[model samples]
Target: MDLDQSVIGLTSNEYVFEVERRHVGQFAAAIGDDHPLYTDEEYANQSAYAGLIVPPTFPIAMNDGKTEMPLALDQRRMLHGEQEFLYYKPIRIGDRLRCQIKVSDLYDKEGKSGKMQFLKLDTEMKDETGELVCISRMNIVYRSLAN
Candidate 1:
Protein backbone atom coordinates (compact mmCIF):
# COMPACT_ATOMS: atom_id res chain seq x y z
CA MET A 1 0.00 0.00 0.00
CA ASP A 2 1.20 3.45 -0.87
CA LEU A 3 0.58 6.49 1.26
CA ASP A 4 -0.55 9.75 -0.30
CA GLN A 5 2.56 11.82 -0.78
CA SER A 6 0.48 14.98 -0.99
CA VAL A 7 -0.29 14.78 2.69
CA ILE A 8 3.27 15.74 3.51
CA GLY A 9 3.54 19.34 4.78
CA LEU A 10 -0.16 19.35 5.68
CA THR A 11 -1.03 20.51 9.16
CA SER A 12 -4.09 19.76 11.22
CA ASN A 13 -6.21 22.40 12.91
CA GLU A 14 -4.96 23.84 16.16
CA TYR A 15 -6.20 22.08 19.29
CA VAL A 16 -6.41 23.86 22.60
CA PHE A 17 -6.19 21.98 25.89
CA GLU A 18 -6.29 23.36 29.40
CA VAL A 19 -4.08 21.47 31.76
CA GLU A 20 -5.86 20.40 34.93
CA ARG A 21 -4.87 18.79 38.18
CA ARG A 22 -6.90 15.70 37.48
CA HIS A 23 -5.27 15.31 34.12
CA VAL A 24 -1.85 15.46 35.68
CA GLY A 25 -2.67 13.10 38.56
CA GLN A 26 -4.46 10.58 36.38
CA PHE A 27 -1.70 10.41 33.82
CA ALA A 28 0.92 10.07 36.52
CA ALA A 29 -1.04 7.30 38.19
CA ALA A 30 -1.70 5.54 34.91
CA ILE A 31 2.01 5.56 34.13
CA GLY A 32 2.87 4.46 37.70
CA ASP A 33 5.01 7.53 38.29
CA ASP A 34 4.86 8.67 41.90
CA HIS A 35 7.24 11.57 41.61
CA PRO A 36 6.56 14.55 43.88
CA LEU A 37 6.28 16.95 40.96
CA TYR A 38 3.53 14.88 39.42
CA THR A 39 1.60 13.88 42.52
CA ASP A 40 2.41 16.17 45.43
CA GLU A 41 1.27 19.75 44.88
CA GLU A 42 2.81 21.02 48.09
CA TYR A 43 6.15 19.47 47.34
CA ALA A 44 6.14 20.90 43.87
CA ASN A 45 5.15 24.36 45.13
CA GLN A 46 8.22 24.43 47.32
CA SER A 47 10.42 23.51 44.39
CA ALA A 48 11.47 25.68 41.47
CA TYR A 49 8.31 25.02 39.48
CA ALA A 50 6.20 26.51 42.33
CA GLY A 51 3.21 24.24 41.67
CA LEU A 52 2.08 20.94 40.28
CA ILE A 53 3.78 19.92 37.09
CA VAL A 54 2.99 17.16 34.65
CA PRO A 55 5.27 14.29 33.80
CA PRO A 56 7.38 14.63 30.69
CA THR A 57 5.24 12.17 28.74
CA PHE A 58 1.91 13.72 29.72
CA PRO A 59 1.62 15.62 26.42
CA ILE A 60 0.88 12.28 24.75
CA ALA A 61 -2.63 12.58 26.15
CA MET A 62 -3.15 16.24 25.27
CA ASN A 63 -3.92 15.54 21.62
CA ASP A 64 -7.20 13.77 22.49
CA GLY A 65 -7.43 12.17 19.02
CA LYS A 66 -7.41 15.65 17.45
CA THR A 67 -4.02 15.10 15.84
CA GLU A 68 -4.94 13.19 12.72
CA MET A 69 -3.54 12.45 9.27
CA PRO A 70 -5.26 13.88 6.24
CA LEU A 71 -5.61 10.38 4.80
CA ALA A 72 -7.25 7.35 6.29
CA LEU A 73 -5.29 4.83 8.31
CA ASP A 74 -5.90 1.19 9.19
CA GLN A 75 -5.36 0.62 12.86
CA ARG A 76 -4.87 -3.11 12.45
CA ARG A 77 -1.95 -2.58 10.06
CA MET A 78 -0.45 0.44 11.81
CA LEU A 79 2.55 0.20 14.12
CA HIS A 80 4.30 2.74 16.34
CA GLY A 81 7.67 3.25 14.70
CA GLU A 82 9.18 5.78 17.09
CA GLN A 83 8.48 8.72 19.38
CA GLU A 84 10.72 11.65 20.33
CA PHE A 85 10.04 14.68 22.50
CA LEU A 86 11.77 17.99 23.18
CA TYR A 87 10.56 20.09 26.09
CA TYR A 88 11.36 23.75 26.55
CA LYS A 89 9.46 24.45 29.76
CA PRO A 90 7.61 22.52 32.43
CA ILE A 91 3.91 22.08 31.81
CA ARG A 92 2.03 23.11 34.91
CA ILE A 93 -1.58 22.80 35.98
CA GLY A 94 -3.95 25.43 34.53
CA ASP A 95 -1.69 26.16 31.59
CA ARG A 96 -3.58 26.51 28.34
CA LEU A 97 -1.81 24.86 25.44
CA ARG A 98 -2.23 25.35 21.71
CA CYS A 99 -1.23 22.34 19.67
CA GLN A 100 -1.03 21.26 16.05
CA ILE A 101 0.31 18.33 14.08
CA LYS A 102 2.07 18.45 10.75
CA VAL A 103 2.83 15.65 8.35
CA SER A 104 6.56 16.07 8.05
CA ASP A 105 7.46 13.16 5.75
CA LEU A 106 6.10 10.04 4.07
CA TYR A 107 7.78 7.23 2.22
CA ASP A 108 7.63 3.53 1.35
CA LYS A 109 10.21 0.83 1.77
CA GLU A 110 10.62 -2.87 1.04
CA GLY A 111 10.32 -5.08 4.08
CA LYS A 112 10.95 -8.75 4.69
CA SER A 113 7.22 -9.41 4.66
CA GLY A 114 6.35 -6.99 1.91
CA LYS A 115 6.31 -3.23 1.29
CA MET A 116 5.73 -0.83 4.17
CA GLN A 117 4.62 2.81 4.32
CA PHE A 118 6.04 5.26 6.83
CA LEU A 119 4.37 8.47 8.03
CA LYS A 120 6.16 11.00 10.16
CA LEU A 121 4.09 13.41 12.26
CA ASP A 122 5.39 16.41 14.17
CA THR A 123 3.29 17.88 16.95
CA GLU A 124 4.09 21.35 18.24
CA MET A 125 2.68 22.74 21.47
CA LYS A 126 2.81 26.26 22.82
CA ASP A 127 1.69 27.84 26.05
CA GLU A 128 -0.95 30.55 26.41
CA THR A 129 1.84 33.10 26.13
CA GLY A 130 2.73 31.68 22.72
CA GLU A 131 6.07 30.32 23.85
CA LEU A 132 6.92 26.88 22.56
CA VAL A 133 6.53 24.28 25.28
CA CYS A 134 7.22 20.99 23.58
CA ILE A 135 7.61 19.31 20.24
CA SER A 136 6.81 15.64 19.72
CA ARG A 137 7.72 13.59 16.67
CA MET A 138 5.99 10.27 16.04
CA ASN A 139 6.57 7.82 13.22
CA ILE A 140 3.88 5.38 12.19
CA VAL A 141 4.54 2.36 10.00
CA TYR A 142 1.86 0.67 7.94
CA ARG A 143 2.14 -2.91 6.76
CA SER A 144 0.89 -3.88 3.34
CA LEU A 145 -2.82 -4.54 3.13
CA ALA A 146 -3.83 -8.17 3.30
CA ASN A 147 -5.03 -9.96 0.25
Candidate 2:
Protein backbone atom coordinates (compact mmCIF):
# COMPACT_ATOMS: atom_id res chain seq x y z
CA MET A 1 0.00 0.00 0.00
CA ASP A 2 2.56 2.55 1.12
CA LEU A 3 6.27 2.83 0.60
CA ASP A 4 8.17 1.73 3.68
CA GLN A 5 11.11 4.06 4.12
CA SER A 6 12.31 2.08 7.10
CA VAL A 7 13.25 -0.75 4.80
CA ILE A 8 15.67 1.35 2.80
CA GLY A 9 19.29 0.30 3.13
CA LEU A 10 18.22 -3.08 4.44
CA THR A 11 20.46 -5.94 3.32
CA SER A 12 19.38 -9.46 2.51
CA ASN A 13 21.12 -12.77 3.05
CA GLU A 14 24.19 -13.56 1.01
CA TYR A 15 24.18 -16.37 -1.55
CA VAL A 16 27.14 -18.20 -2.99
CA PHE A 17 27.02 -20.00 -6.31
CA GLU A 18 29.53 -21.98 -8.28
CA VAL A 19 29.32 -21.24 -11.96
CA GLU A 20 29.37 -24.21 -14.30
CA ARG A 21 29.91 -24.34 -18.06
CA ARG A 22 26.74 -26.29 -18.68
CA HIS A 23 24.62 -23.73 -16.84
CA VAL A 24 26.25 -20.91 -18.78
CA GLY A 25 25.59 -22.60 -22.10
CA GLN A 26 22.01 -23.28 -21.15
CA PHE A 27 21.41 -19.71 -20.12
CA ALA A 28 22.91 -18.41 -23.35
CA ALA A 29 20.72 -20.71 -25.38
CA ALA A 30 17.63 -19.76 -23.40
CA ILE A 31 18.29 -16.11 -24.19
CA GLY A 32 18.74 -16.88 -27.88
CA ASP A 33 22.34 -15.79 -27.87
CA ASP A 34 24.40 -17.87 -30.27
CA HIS A 35 27.76 -16.37 -29.56
CA PRO A 36 30.62 -18.81 -29.60
CA LEU A 37 32.04 -17.38 -26.40
CA TYR A 38 29.09 -18.69 -24.49
CA THR A 39 28.09 -21.78 -26.39
CA ASP A 40 31.37 -23.15 -27.78
CA GLU A 41 33.92 -24.35 -25.33
CA GLU A 42 36.57 -24.90 -27.99
CA TYR A 43 36.09 -21.41 -29.36
CA ALA A 44 36.12 -19.87 -25.91
CA ASN A 45 39.25 -21.78 -25.02
CA GLN A 46 41.04 -20.28 -27.99
CA SER A 47 39.68 -16.76 -27.50
CA ALA A 48 40.94 -14.09 -25.18
CA TYR A 49 38.75 -15.28 -22.33
CA ALA A 50 40.50 -18.65 -22.44
CA GLY A 51 37.36 -20.23 -20.92
CA LEU A 52 33.61 -20.23 -21.04
CA ILE A 53 32.19 -16.82 -20.22
CA VAL A 54 28.66 -16.25 -19.09
CA PRO A 55 26.23 -13.84 -20.61
CA PRO A 56 25.83 -10.43 -19.08
CA THR A 57 22.44 -11.15 -17.57
CA PHE A 58 23.38 -14.61 -16.44
CA PRO A 59 23.82 -13.36 -12.89
CA ILE A 60 20.06 -13.40 -12.54
CA ALA A 61 20.20 -17.12 -12.02
CA MET A 62 22.94 -16.82 -9.45
CA ASN A 63 20.88 -14.38 -7.42
CA ASP A 64 17.70 -16.40 -7.56
CA GLY A 65 16.17 -16.89 -4.09
CA LYS A 66 19.18 -15.03 -2.75
CA THR A 67 17.62 -11.67 -2.09
CA GLU A 68 14.40 -10.32 -0.61
CA MET A 69 12.92 -7.11 0.64
CA PRO A 70 12.64 -6.54 4.37
CA LEU A 71 8.94 -5.69 4.14
CA ALA A 72 5.84 -7.80 3.79
CA LEU A 73 4.76 -6.65 0.34
CA ASP A 74 2.02 -8.38 -1.60
CA GLN A 75 3.64 -10.52 -4.23
CA ARG A 76 0.58 -10.65 -6.43
CA ARG A 77 0.53 -6.87 -6.86
CA MET A 78 4.22 -6.41 -7.48
CA LEU A 79 5.54 -5.64 -10.97
CA HIS A 80 9.04 -5.74 -12.26
CA GLY A 81 9.69 -2.19 -13.46
CA GLU A 82 13.29 -2.07 -14.60
CA GLN A 83 16.65 -3.78 -14.37
CA GLU A 84 20.24 -2.69 -14.98
CA PHE A 85 23.62 -4.33 -14.75
CA LEU A 86 27.16 -3.01 -14.34
CA TYR A 87 30.01 -5.43 -14.79
CA TYR A 88 33.52 -4.91 -13.55
CA LYS A 89 34.74 -8.14 -15.10
CA PRO A 90 33.44 -11.08 -17.06
CA ILE A 91 32.03 -14.07 -15.19
CA ARG A 92 33.69 -17.34 -16.13
CA ILE A 93 32.88 -20.94 -15.43
CA GLY A 94 34.39 -22.46 -12.28
CA ASP A 95 34.22 -19.15 -10.45
CA ARG A 96 32.49 -18.96 -7.10
CA LEU A 97 30.32 -15.89 -6.85
CA ARG A 98 28.76 -14.31 -3.80
CA CYS A 99 25.71 -12.14 -4.14
CA GLN A 100 23.83 -9.97 -1.65
CA ILE A 101 20.78 -7.81 -2.02
CA LYS A 102 20.40 -4.35 -0.58
CA VAL A 103 17.34 -2.15 -0.54
CA SER A 104 18.67 1.03 -2.06
CA ASP A 105 15.63 3.28 -2.19
CA LEU A 106 11.86 3.45 -1.75
CA TYR A 107 9.35 6.03 -2.93
CA ASP A 108 5.72 6.55 -3.82
CA LYS A 109 4.02 8.56 -6.53
CA GLU A 110 0.55 9.22 -7.90
CA GLY A 111 0.25 7.88 -11.40
CA LYS A 112 -2.50 7.95 -14.03
CA SER A 113 -3.56 4.47 -12.98
CA GLY A 114 -3.20 4.96 -9.25
CA LYS A 115 -0.72 5.41 -6.44
CA MET A 116 2.43 3.33 -7.04
CA GLN A 117 5.24 2.48 -4.72
CA PHE A 118 8.71 1.92 -6.16
CA LEU A 119 11.25 -0.27 -4.47
CA LYS A 120 14.86 -0.19 -5.67
CA LEU A 121 17.16 -3.06 -4.93
CA ASP A 122 20.85 -3.51 -5.64
CA THR A 123 22.48 -6.90 -5.82
CA GLU A 124 26.26 -6.97 -5.72
CA MET A 125 28.09 -9.97 -7.12
CA LYS A 126 31.66 -10.61 -6.16
CA ASP A 127 34.05 -13.39 -6.95
CA GLU A 128 35.87 -15.51 -4.40
CA THR A 129 38.92 -13.33 -4.98
CA GLY A 130 36.99 -10.40 -3.43
CA GLU A 131 36.65 -8.62 -6.75
CA LEU A 132 33.37 -7.15 -7.88
CA VAL A 133 32.04 -9.02 -10.88
CA CYS A 134 28.78 -7.20 -11.37
CA ILE A 135 26.08 -5.03 -9.77
CA SER A 136 22.43 -5.42 -10.65
CA ARG A 137 19.85 -2.75 -9.92
CA MET A 138 16.23 -3.80 -10.00
CA ASN A 139 13.14 -1.63 -9.61
CA ILE A 140 9.81 -3.07 -8.56
CA VAL A 141 6.46 -1.29 -8.64
CA TYR A 142 3.82 -2.15 -6.10
CA ARG A 143 0.34 -1.13 -7.19
CA SER A 144 -2.56 -0.78 -4.83
CA LEU A 145 -5.03 -3.62 -5.22
CA ALA A 146 -7.90 -1.18 -5.42
CA ASN A 147 -6.43 0.30 -8.54
lDDT of 1 by residue, 76-127 (tens): 8889989988888888888889998888899989899888889888888999
Compared with the true structure, model 1 gives a TM-score of 0.85
Candidate 2 vs. true structure, TM-score = 0.85
Give TM per candidate. Answer: 0.85, 0.85
Query: What is the C-alpha lDDT profile of model 2 across 51-133, one tens digit per residue?
Result: 77888888878855635655667888889999998888888888888888888898999998877888988888898888899
Instruction: State in Å the error of residue 49, model 1.
Output: 4.9
Q: 24, model 1: CA deviation in Å?
A: 0.8
Q: Provide the clash count, candidate 1.
A: 0
> Clash number for model 2?
0
Cα error, residue 89 of model 1, in Å, equals: 1.7
For all candidates, the clash counts are: 0, 0
Q: For each candidate, what is the lDDT?
A: 0.85, 0.83
